[model samples]
Target chain A: MSNPARAESIAQLERLVAALLAKGVVSEAELAAQQASTDRASPETGARMVARAWLDPEWRAMMLKNGTAAAEAMGVSMAGAPPLGVLEDTAKRHHVIVCTLCSCYPRAVLGYPPHWYKSFSYRSRVVREPRAVMAEWGSPVADDVELRVVDSTADYRWMVLPLRPAGTEGWTEDQLAALVTRDVLVGVALPKLPA
Target chain B: MNPRFSPGSRVLVKNDWPEERGPCHIRTPHYLRGRAGEVERVLGAFRNPEDLAFARPAETRVLYHVMFDQPGIFPADGKQPDKLLVEIFEHWLEAA
Candidate 1:
């Protein structure tokens, strides 16, 4: 059975869109084009960028310096999205991203955000107790290592360029890309060799 | 518009809330209000989200990357030595 509240919300949105369409505020074609663009992006795009960065030092430097340009170089369309900021994870420091206010993710590269990323608990708890939150994800940060929690509070969107794991030195980009997942890109988990 | 704050300079998030009452799109988080932090970078000018939310004629404002110590934000959390970076607009900041 359909949830009544959700159905009502959808109906309300449809009505609102219909009203806008009637007034020519937003055209149906424009909406379809936006959806198509959004559909074209996914975590694979980010994984490919990460894999390429791991293999090429210059590409890695560029990715660290300007994430949007790096993503564009990888053929990801940044079009109307906010500037992307790539946070590089090092041996002594780890970076995790959160939008304490809202789910402001790097949608141009990583596609849509997961449900957990928009949850109130994740938004509230992650900022106050990030180490604890990561531990819950089975990816605890070491006490000695510096943990930086990046809050995408305003215009900029962020993603983590996790350090490449060992034992994959001679791996091809495709093989390395397979190890990078959405959670890994978000810094909630680290990429590991297949068991 | 030029950026008011430079990288490495200290600034504080304004403790007061916007005069406008009721719900509004505010980028500055409540926890960061009144907190002191060092400017990490100048992110250039962007339209003020507060005005943009209402579809008003908005003016561009300089945004900044501010870094605050974890322990400083949460004093009771002890010496964790962690850091938190937030993207804050110029209007919400002042020289600390």
Candidate 2:
């Protein structure tokens, strides 16, 4: 941890955070709160909603229509965060979410985004060659299914409600929830039954 | 303020960047400029991030989630018919 390279990165991060604070872009308390909130919304929370939507048709409708309200109803406090949009995947359509500018994501429900999700390559490449990028991620879309790439360019963060895998009938919420991975929520991969 | 465009309105993103705003900071992506798309959702008026970046009082502008065709954006690379949705401010758009 005391290596020169590591020290340089640490210093860079410190400078960036300090600059943001000084510029009134974000406050210390707000940054701390966001960090704490990210800890609370793990993949489990995402799974919980996805599982609930899978079980209850009404909840699924609500989730697709307005994800911010759905997250609030599920007791996830997303105060000061932008509105959430849950893109439901169906037989005909698949959805993927990315932030071409800065990586704006549904951190309250899906936690922090992966490092790759914030990469410049991902931001530029995905928009141009979605199918190729998706295929590389191991989530190849079928020829018949239409792909929808959503860019988090403004004040709304987005997540994906992937299609429920087959053969999980009569499964408990916790069991089904476990299958809903963060990758699925980000649309980089899909949930699968146990092999 | 009443929004100029509603959901499903066909609009083209303004390609010009007003010189008065200067060139330091802008939220609208370069790839989306001049692209024709339909307003998928109307996000209410909010402080413009471009102005906010400079620590100035941001003038509120209506935002929209505009949906564009993949081919229209990346014609050569667009193998599959897909949709690309980007949020754009009302000022950066005009009825197509």
Candidate 3:
């Protein structure tokens, strides 16, 4: 079941795309290619970057300095995508991203924004009562830890580089990537060691 | 395009819109107007989205990573974090 307003909006978008295609402004092949590239990097792309950063200091530096470039270096196209800002979660600070106006996400790397991320409550309350909202996710940041809430209000989309969990000394990059779930990518939860 | 502010420079968001620019398809969020922040990074030049939204020739403008303190945005017994970053176009900023 879909809300009538949302269904109408989706229909309008489909019509617009169809018109663009009919006018040759966008070729069908081009449209398909762009759609494919839109999600070229799944959540695994973020995970791979984090895993590599954990293992390689230089790569970590690059990811911290310029997330878009770092993603491209990892063979992610990122063409026609907005600039990506990777917020590093550290011992002293934690990071969370929300677009108060709309769900502006780094889809090239993080795939699609989650459902709750686009909800009105999450968008509105996260900016005002981030701690309370975060607590609902069951990954509350300790009071001592400074929480940085990044609002992707413009063309810049943000993502979190979650801290590497302990007790995984000999874990391979693939294993580390496996630990990175959608929640971790969204900064609501942290990656954990396998039980 | 020459950017107004460089990375790491402090800047203030303009409280008011530019003269005679009718408000339609503006990208700068209302919450950030008149707010002060530091340019965390330079995002290079891009076609002005405000102009592009209206089907006009999109003049390029520099975009910056503007970082604001959470306390400054929301004060009084809140656990809202230390910083909030937003991407603002050069046109919306002035040297602090």
Candidate 4:
């Protein structure tokens, strides 16, 4: 059964869209095209980039230098989107991303953000107590590592380039990409070797 | 306009709370207001989002990547080796 409040919100949105369509402000084809583009986006695109970067030094350099160009080179359309910033995680430094003001994610690369990412609890707590928050998600950062919380509060959208897990040196690109889940790209979790 | 601050320059975020009628859109988070940090990079110029939100003719403003120590934002956290990075417009920042 659909929730009443959600159903009402959907109805309201539909009504608004219908009004816009009737006014010729937007066309059906345009809406369909937009939806198709959004549907084409997912975390797989980002995982592919990460897998390729891990295997190629030049690709990694380009990704670190310009994330938007890297994404476009990988066949992902970043037109009209804000510049994407790839935050590289290293041995001594770890990075986590948040948008305390709103849900400003790299939607073209990582798709829409998870529901929890948009919740008030996450937007408020992550910047304040990131370690405690990550621990709750079963990913803990050591005290020795410098944990940097990146706030995508303005124009630039951010995604994490997690350090490749050990023991996956000989793995194929497909295998390496499989290890990078959506949470890993967001920096809430790290990829690990299969148990 | 050219960027007013360069990378490695220490800057402070203004703590002003502008009052305006009707809908308002502010990109700077309240937690970062009044905090001091260093410019990590100059991210070029873009139209002022505050004006853009209202569909006004927005002026281009330089944006900066600012890095701050976590303990500086939260004093009770003690001297932890953690940091925070935020993208703040040049208008909201001043040389500290």
**In model 3, what are the clashing residue pairs, if there are any?**
none
Which tens-of-lDDT digit does each residue in A107-172 have in candidate 1?
889998998999888888777788888889988889997888999988889999999999998999
| Model 2: residue A190 alpha-carbon error in angstroms | 1.8
Evaluated on chain B only, what are the TM-scores of all the candidate structures, in order? 0.90, 0.88, 0.84, 0.89
Error of 3 at A60 (Å): 1.6
Q: In model 3, which regions exceed 4 Å deviation?
A: A1-11, B17-23
CA lDDT, every model vs. true structure: 0.89, 0.86, 0.82, 0.89
For candidate 4, lDDT tens digit of each residue in A1-195? 222568788999999999999999999998898899888899999999999999999999999999999999988878888999899999988888988887899999999788888888888888888888888988898889889999988899999999999899899999999999999999988887788
Span of ten consecutive residues with least summed lDDT in model 4 chain A: A1-10
DockQ each: 0.75, 0.76, 0.55, 0.74
Over A1-195, each residue of candidate 3 has an lDDT whose tens digit, in order, gives: 124568788999999999998888999898888888875658888888889998999999999889999989978887777887888989988888888877888888888777888999887777767787778887877888888777876777788998888888988999989998877877878787766
Q: Please, what are the lDDT tens digits per residue for candidate 2 over residues A54-77?
A: 999999999988899999998889
Clashing pairs in 4: none
The superposed Cα distance between candidate 1 and the true structure at residue A83, in angstroms, equals 1.2
Docking class of 1: medium
The per-prediction i-RMS, to one decimal, reads 1.4, 1.1, 2.2, 1.4
Residue A7's lDDT within candidate 1 is 75
Off by over 4 Å in 4: A1-8, A19-25, B19-23, B77-79
Q: Is 1 or 2 the stronger prediction by DockQ? A: 2
Q: How would you class the docking of model 3?
A: medium
TM-score of chain A of 1: 0.92
Predicted candidate 2 versus true structure: per-residue lDDT over B8-92, tens digit per residue? 8999998876655766666678888888999998877878987888888889999888999987789988765698988899999
